[model samples]
Target: MRAKAVRMYGTRDLRLEEFELPEIRDDEILAKIYSDSICMSTYKLVEQGKKHKRAPQNMDTHPVIVGHEFAGVIVKVGKKWQDQFQPGMRFAQQPALNYKGSLASPGYSYEWYGGDTTYCIFPHETMELGALMPFDGDSFYKASLGEPMSCCIGGYHAMYHTNKQNYDHEMGTKRGGNILIAGGCGPMGLGSVSYGLVCDYHPRRIVVTDVDDAKIERAKEVVSPEYAAEHGVELIYANTAKMDDPRQGLMDLTQGHGYDDVFVMVPIPSVCQLAGSVLAFDGCLNFFSGPTDKNFSASMNMYDLHYTSTHLMGTTGGNNDDLIEANQLAASGRLDPSVMITHVGGIDSIAETTLNLPKIKGGKKLAYTQFDMPMTAIEDFAKLGKSDPFFAKLDQCCRDHKGLWNPEAERMLFEHKGVKVEV
Candidate 1:
């Protein structure tokens, strides 16, 4: 089958090209991608290319596809997996296939298997390892956000508290304790806050800090104070840039007990350091950011680390279990992953949008893989309304959600744009 995909050939060489796919083996399944949420990690992969550890050494022989956070429909089920998954079934996956400790994954390591493409291949290991997940969600984009949401979930799970006496470490943060999310206005940071509020993470108090006041305001809107109060969570948003002493402000919120769990979202050494300094007794600091620097290091107070039982931990990608949990939470209306998305476009916009993701602020940039549309921010719908009728309806939908993208907006977008939804 011939398909179009954004492929990484070398460092800083991501090209949207047409390519032919090989016949699906009896042990493989073929799927048609519907939606993919562009992640910052994808930007990293695009810049690093062959230099990326998971990427093949020789791009001349092994070009790779460029997305992982995606949802699709099974177009052709393999004979061997006929009883398990059928054609037309909706599917998503945990692309972190840490198979026997191998560094390879679908979006980064495979040539014909990735989310950016119109079609993708699911190998036997993908199904055997149970990474391929079938979801019953209202929006394909919401299902696609599951991968990134699972990554946030995995970070919470990976945090461990140390026993000062025996030095034994226990996984997970303190239940019903205070948690601080540094740079909480970003997409992944918002995901962490949403999961903490909805899931069993049981955060009694959650403090979200960001340097950008506008982002903090939007974050507040996404996870409102009323919603947090209903869940018995004291949610606080702080513009750290305005504070003379950010640490003092955070301490005052926690009554000097400090945060029990600190999630560092920004990939800056200084932000990681700041997050570490605000840890309480037996606190676990989660380094959730992926740094581009190979030798990234942050100064830590070793004395406080040993006496206060504060430790730091990090994880790259989530396992299959996390993906399942994320999908279930989103599908059951427990987790609204749509809050993390700010812009919507089609496959045509992926290349430019991905290349300039850091510059494009607000939240996750979503792509309709089958459609041919320009990148459109929810905020721009009002301006676009005067020119296009479809955008006029989209502007109203955005207004209905207080300038946010909702399932209703996604459905209306397809309807007005004359795009068919494959069930």
Candidate 2:
């Protein structure tokens, strides 16, 4: 069968091309992708291409598809998996396969398997390793957001603190302790704050710092201080750019005691240094940002590291269990990841939006694989609606939902611009 997808042929070489897919083997499954939200990691993938660890070395020949945070419906279940997954069932992918310590992963390693594609083949390993997960969410976009939300869950789980009794590391963040998400107003940063409110172990306070005022303001609207208070957590959005001494200002919010857990959201060395400076006794500084530079270094306070027992940590893509937890959070209405997505597009918008993801000023750029429309931000819906009726309807849906993307907006998008399959 033929399907359209954005494939990486080489470094910064992404093409939205229609290609043929091989017949699904008895051990494999065929699926139709609906929603895929672009991630920063995917932008890094395009920049490095075959040089990326998860990407195969021969991308010039065997091109790989370029998205992982995706959700879809099972179009045809393979004979071997009939009892497990059936056609028309919703599914979400946990792309960090990490099979047997191999670097192979979907989006970067496979030719006919990725989120950008209208259709894809799930290899046997996706099921064998239980990475292909059932998504019981209201919309396919939420299912796509699950992949990144799971990443946030994994970061939360990966944090470790100094166990005073044994002095051994205790996994997970400190409960009822002050928390900080530096450079956190971005997509994932917003998610980290939202999760902090409803996480099993609640924090006393969550201080989010970002350099951009617009982003900080937008984040507040999504997870406001009032909303956080209802969950018994004090949330503060601080724009460090406005502060003369951001480090001092941030420390003041914690009453000079510092934070128990600090998650660094940006790859900037200064942001990382700032996060390190605000660590309290036995604080766990999570290096959540993935820098492209191999020699990226930051100066941390070594005195506190030695005497305060403050430590650093880092984690990559999430595991299948994290994905499951993320799904549960979304299902139970505990984690609304809508703050992560900013723009919506169609399959035709994949290549450009992905190739220049960093240039696109937004959180997650969601694309519905079956549609044909330009990439448009939710904020611009009203602007575009002034001239176009299709956008006018989509604008109303978003306006009704507090200018955020929701299932109704997705439904109206489909109703206005029905499926357009060239193949």
TM-score of each: 0.97, 0.97
Best by TM-score: 2
lDDT of 2 by residue, 1-423 (tens): 889998999989998899889999999999989889988898888888777888898888989988999999888878889999888889888998878888788888998889998899999998999999888888888899999999888998999887668868778889999999998988999989988999987999999998788898889888899999999999999988888898899899998989999999989988888889888999999999899887899998888888989898898778888899999888777788888888999999988988888888978899999877789899998888899887888888877766789887887777677653221
RMSD of 1: 1.5
lDDT of 1 by residue, 18-66 (tens): 8899999999999999889998988888888778888888775778888
Clashes of each: 0, 0
Clashing pairs in 2: none
lDDT measured at residue 115 in model 1 versus the true structure, 0 to 100: 92
Q: State each model's CA lDDT, in order.
A: 0.86, 0.88
Candidate 1 ranges beyond 4 A from true positions: 162-168
TM-score of 2: 0.97
Candidate 2 — worst ten consecutive residues by lDDT sum?
A: 414-423
